[model samples]
Target: MVRISQQRVKCIGCNACVEAAPYRWRMSRKDGKCTLIQAVEKRGMFNILVTDDEYDANVDAAMHCPVNCIKIEQV
Candidate 1:
């Protein structure tokens, strides 16, 4: 399962996640942050759904964030 830590998401409204994983990610206008819309179902646990094809791009977006926020992990 893949997960992104909310604490580390500074979400500059770039919508990179949304573009990369349209089925799973979105931007929350209320909070000006990007959020995962779907949950991964595996090992009796739920994590954010980040597709394999979009993984590297999303990770790059996170790493290149001006605020240095965004956390991606697999468990």
Candidate 2:
């Protein structure tokens, strides 16, 4: 399974994750920070799954995040 950490303290509100993985990431209106609104489910395992085309986009977002808040993990 893949998952993103929910610690909002590290988020810089840069919206990198939102741009990289639009399907997985979203911006919160209250704070303008990027977050995962849904989980990626596959084969009974939950992953931080994004489309193949979104891989680079998401990676780029993670890299560009000023606070380095976005965490992509495999479980």
Candidate 3:
């Protein structure tokens, strides 16, 4: 399985992720951080559930984030 995380503390409101992968990323109104488009919480972590087809886009979004706040892990 694959997962993505946005460390809000490192987010700088730069919309790179949104520009790269609007399908999987968006800006949060409360904090202006880039958040997963349809993120869900599990085990105290917020993550996006993506299909294989969406994987590359998500990874690209992570890579494009100027603040480097995004993280990806496989389990």
Candidate 4:
């Protein structure tokens, strides 16, 4: 499994994550922040769990994040 976490409040809507992994991330029309697909919010952070197949793409997303708000980890 893989865990993806995003500090949505810190997002600048730069579109890096969305570009890297469109299947897992999207831009919020309501707030202009990048949204972690199917994520659950807790303590101002958004998190989602996915199969290991997602690891590489999300890792690219996290690495490309300008504000470094996105994180990917093996679980």
lDDT of 3 by residue, 1-75 (tens): 667877666789899888878877778899887777667766645776555676777788878878777887664
Candidate 2 collision pairs: 2-47, 2-48, 20-57, 20-58
Task: Report the C-alpha lDDT of model 1 over 1-75, residue by residue, as the tens digit.
Answer: 445544423457777666755655677878877665665444533356554665676676567556645567765
Candidate 4 lDDT, 1-75, residue by residue in tens: 999999889999999999989999988899998999999999999998999999999999999999999888898
Error of 4 at 26 (Å): 0.7
Q: Which ten residues in a row have the lowest lDDT in candidate 1?
A: 1-10
Error of 4 at 53 (Å): 0.4
Rate residue 71 of model 1 by lDDT.
63
lDDT of each: 0.59, 0.62, 0.76, 0.94
Better model by TM-score, 2 or 4? 4
Which candidate model has the greater lDDT, 2 or 4?
Answer: 4
Residue-level lDDT of model 2, residues 1-75, one tens digit each, is 344544565666777777776777788898876666675544533336544555555566667778765556554
Which ranges in model 4 have alpha carbons more than 4 Å from their true place? none
Q: Which candidate, 1 or 2, has the higher TM-score?
A: 2
TM-score of 2: 0.60
